[model samples]
Target chain A: MGLKKISDNTYEIFEEGMNVPARIFASKKILESVEKDRTIEQIKNVAKLPGILKYALALPDAHQGYGFPIGGVAAFDMDKGIISPGGVGYDINCSVRLLKTNLKKEDILKKQKEVVEELYRKIPSGVGRGSRLQITRKELNNILEGGAKYIVEKMKMGKTEDYLHMEEEGCMEDADSKKVSERAMNRGIGQLGTIGAGNHFLEVQYVDEIFDEKVAKSFGIKKGQVTIMIHCGSRGLGHQVASDYIQMMEKEYGFQNLPDRELINAPIKSRLGKDYYSAMCAAANFAFANKQIITHWVREELVRIFPKVKIDVVYDVCHNIAKFEEQIIDGKKRKICIHRKGATRAFGPGRKEIPEAYRKIGQPVIIPGSMGTASYLLVGTKKSEEISFGSTVHGAGRVASRSEALREIKGEDIKKEMNEEGIEVKAGSWKSLAEEAPEAYKDIDEVARVVDELGISKKVARLKPLVVIKG
Target chain B: MKFKFLEHTADVKFQAFGKNEEEVFENSADALKEAICDKKKIKAAEKKDITVEGGDYESLLYKFLEEIIYLLEAEDFLISKVKEIKIKNFRLKAVLSGDKASDYNFNNEVKAVTYNEMFVKKIKNEWVAQVVLDV
Candidate 1:
């Protein structure tokens, strides 16, 4: 791959087989770490997708993944484009939600232990934990189609403000349950409201520092204020949808000469592609509802542990999912299918798609840290249009494999270290906890800084964990 | 049956080896169950019929392992033993038996079977299957 440095935080990949060049938003250190993996080649392969427009860009947290690299972003012309299941990832609509509490860090520290325990009890975690809500098959179908709006409007789980803060208002339009497979539906049964294992978590943190005070204030975050973040996705339902469609697409459009079989895709206008879009939306909806239900449980637990703690949702955004978005391409606004594999849309201020309340300040970009690191809250910048297709880093991307982490780090030692640092932890399994050790991931602050330096996303506030619940 | 877990950044990966294709398929099914929970602790107290089809050796193995994941996720049915298995052309038939998820001690969760680095081939006259499961 021919590489050229466009700026201090931007690099362009001009390779032989690429349809378009790939731009990476990372500093030299971040680039060095990624070069140790196959993420660079994966980004180059993503550039070869049909009708891939602009640049197949990777964020600062980029890491090696199956077809498309994690933290990879690309846009394709609606008609000329193709939709790949690998582009959306196995965990459809895996996202992050940040909640703001009226209390300060001092208030949380006093009740951290009790609050963490209550939360673990209220919200089931771990493998195959049954739903707390007894939803019938009919209601479950509605949720599969309705998303977060179904939980809020129909089930009365949340208020209008709660729905407003979400990426798609908790429901994705054009979600056809018929497109969802029975096997996928079967996997979803009794699996709602769970924070499944492997890198998913619920963290209680405080705004430890403010970089952009004005933007932080606009987002209802302040230095020393308490906040909570939920990191998870659609669970088995989403994975099944991806698996089902990957097989379907491979059968329909045989991948005889693709870079990888995992990169199998269908033309966006094809029947199979349309069916996949519908099913993917359905799974994304489940993710929204999953977070909403957990929010309800968190609020209930918070009130019991610390009275008068008013928790308000700051923002919720999906990191893994593809959406048909209209973006300015070659001076004309065009609808393009934006595939954000392990990336998040960083639509800058004035984008009508974002919540009106924060449209002036730009969409809130939530980048979670590893198990015991500093997470960041940033806002999209207008310059993103010229960069990563208005997409940014998802989280502290992993550099170490789970097996390596399990062999090198012990769960008990991590737990003890976090305790010493005044952070509480509850995990489903020690092995899983070890796999999620902070050392397994890249430095999140350094990752976020690259995009911030590039002016794609500007840092607002930094958060340090007080309590972490890993499933 | 012989199986060894591999390394993946995002998911659980493993490879199963056997003397022949059927043995490899059965061993991979065992590998999938092992990914979910400790195989030694599970009991084969029940039985259910299983059948699947694929175009080739890779797809056949892919679908076979996928069936095991579907059983665990959808029906909450765990597989402790493979009572029988037969492969003819591109079709595979088998019987799996186990108890409900709630009845046993389970460890990790495997969301779905992914095609990343998935393949089945006879290398050195020994059938081997590799898979990376989304966990």
Candidate 2:
């Protein structure tokens, strides 16, 4: 497949065979940086899938992935399109959320080590780590069916207002527990409220700069103020679901017949597709609940340390997984399965999906940079609908794998560098620190610049890490 | 034939070069077992038959490994040694034996197997399969 440079920061994957002439928005420099990656091939492969509506899109942070590229966005006609677990990724609903606090940077710096240590102890980390609370089979079923709503309604962890600020209210009504296998349930039973390893973390940051004062104020972010961001997902249960469905789809859909088995998929109308969707949604809900429980835990830890510190959730968004949403294409409202793998939804202002309070300011897009770099807070724009399906880059896309990262950067040295840079770092294992070294990812500012220049999303505020806790 | 583990952003990859596909599959499973549990502690005292059905050879290989992972976690059975292995178009049947949970020395705990970087290909009349297991 030949790609043509349409603009300084954009490339067009011309329509060939089954594709609809896809377009990728990125800077010339960013495109050159990712040209050698297999993600380009994966994006073209996605264009060949059956019933792909509009264009098979990719964000600036795109990288090679299972079936689709990470940071990929594609919408398929719900009636004729196929759903592949590979598109949603193994870590279902792997997402990020920002919590605004009344405390300032000086306040956190006074007790940075203590607060991070307390958070590390309160939040379970590492692989196969389970939370302090173990759920019975019955409760697990409720979690699968009800999602975060169940926790707020039954467990009283948070209120309905909390869900209102979340994407989809932290639950998809289509979640069906019966479709989930027992083995998957077993994996999720004790994993809630736990932060798994590998690129997942909870960082305490300070507002370094405000790009859009209106949007930043709307998100309750003020310069020099403190905030905490949680990055995690459904844990083992989501992985099992992806595995279970990938095999099932391979058999039911005859993967060999497809151009790429990695893109193995079943029509959304098929039983296998429906079951996977239901199970995937359930896993996504599990992630929402997991984060909710973690929020409560963080609040508890804050109360223990600084009783005066008050923290409120700004917004939560899922970067992975697919959702059924209505988008106008060719002046017709059509239902499409929007697959956002390693991407985030950036609904512009006045969009009904935005929370009532945020309806005037657009959806808050939280883009977390690497461990040491600056993170950003952006908002959706109307132009995003024309380019991406109201989607944007999730984070600083990886430039190196864990092995490569470890080879080039040492964990202890990275920790030392972060400390010297005025950022406190703590992790269950040093290996994790090296694996997530800042050098492993692209400069997030360039990624944000591409989207901003393309009018996809507007910058709201920039955040600098004060303390990072990794599992 | 030598087998080594290759790490990815999301999964643990294994590259095994062998004289034949069967040998590679067997070694791939062995490499995965070594990664999960200590081979020395897994005694061949118990015998179990494993069969995985799939739509193609690659998917079959994935399911086959997934079955082994399940047995290791659910029954604490490790594949210390491979007694027999059989592969068809869409099915992998194996006869394996191992002991219960004991002192195990393992490098990385594979949480699950993903469809990422998963393929079975035939090159120069020899079969080679590459799989990335989620760690």
Candidate 3:
């Protein structure tokens, strides 16, 4: 457990016998915060996994985690490496999206309460609340495989550009419905478009400041402009997929043989690995489609309130996933499975993955802070490829657990405090509100500063939340 | 004596406390087993020897749990309990016993193990491990 400080903002946990060295990017303060938890050890465990290429890297928001630390990024050689369900997370494709509207702060303030209430009424929130799209198993399968593109093609809610703005263009080509278990399909059959509980939210925000005017303008973001942010992902279906795979891997993969059981992985070429990958991709697609449908609903609600208001998508990015992409490692292009858990893909400008419209400004990285704090809009830098494999922090990583937050502050009181600060908060349950209190998470500003200092990503704009709908 | 499923977004989470690391590991396994099926029906069959190696205690635990998960998936064996757990700085070897269920029966399927909200710490003199399995 000896860690060598590589730089002022970086540390390296060298690989021992049968281990790879783990590199962690963070400030001294962030490192100290992680040291208090079990994340450092977990990072070391990730290094021991089979076929782990390069280094197992942890971001600034690192904290204790199961197989990999939250905010962990690792790349594995596609030819020799394995894919683990633990790496992708249970909520497969849990992501965030930003939609810009024509309305300004003044216009939103005129009907803020009404707009917020309208959103709550239109979109279902809380645990187990299903949306209006109640499809059978057959339809659900299509949703799983189709993703946002399917929704766009079938539902005709948005254009092809909507999909283009998304990571992987909203649909992963390898998604195979047959790879998903019947039980997993059943769990997801009725849950599409629903906003589940615990940290999932839909917020109305205002662009208060623009740091990178060129990038902000490219994204159609302007000062005092109103925007909506959707934060959600594959629900029960993705969970069931993870659960089924974990159990299957546990029983099938011998513990004594592998470097780490929590990193229980199937060879990329193995049947189990292929099935899990296909199903995981399906779940990821389901998440994209779910968010797309929700976006349609959000648009409908806005139009109902502000008849002339126009809400257009800014960008959508997946935060939890294992994607295969070619990156120049050691000056040679190599395909690797980049597992970004509690992290985001920060591809530099002009990368093929970025939309053509944004080829000049780079991919927009949205880092949402706590409900009461200021969120940031950042653009990827070429420097990120060297430091983090083109990855960045996802959010204000949680510093306090739900129980701890509930014990420290009352939900009602927190709500009152937000109200006084000119923010509106709405949730189906108080416990949900308490679990997501601002104090429960790390200071996002500090996390952003570290990423900026490291040149992984550059801040583009700052956003202030006006209304929040939590489930 | 047993773990209860706490509501998580897409995973089955359990919080348990034990007097020692061995008990904590045993209890965490028990929690995971319970999460998969009815504990009363999951009887111990032939004993199985399992070993996991990691760079640290936490990784060792993760490897240990993954081993159990692999066994269940590959062999359809449902582990009932951990009989012994011996841990060093970065290596863990343990003995576990469980039966292969004729049919899979559980409330939820855990897809993978996540590093989200994962913990193994000491509270006073007792050891506590909390994990959020990706379901």
- Best of the candidates, TM-score: 1
Second chain alone, TM-score for each candidate: 0.93, 0.85, 0.88
Docking class of 2: acceptable
| TM-score, first chain, each model | 0.98, 0.98, 0.97
Q: What is the lDDT of residue B94 in candidate 1?
A: 94
lDDT of each residue in A311-367, candidate 2, tens digit only = 788999999989888887767878889899999998887888888989987898989
Write one digit per residue (lDDT tens) for candidate 3, span A310-379: 8787889898898888898768888888899889999997799988888887899999897678888999
The alpha-carbon deviation from the true structure for residue B66 of candidate 3, after best TM-score superposition, in angstroms, is 16
TM-score of 3: 0.81
In candidate 2, stretches whose alpha carbon ends up further than 4 angstroms from where it belongs are: B5-11, B19-22, B33-51, B68-112, B121-127
- Give me candidate 2's TM-score against the actual structure: 0.92
Question: How does model 2 fare in lDDT?
Answer: 0.81
> What lDDT tens digits, residue by residue, belong to model 2 across residues B60-134?
777778877666544556677667888777677888887664334333346677666677777787667788776
Clashes of each: 1, 1, 31
RMSD of each: 1.4, 3.0, 8.3
- At residue A461, give the lDDT of candidate 3: 88
Chain A alone, model 1, TM-score?
0.98
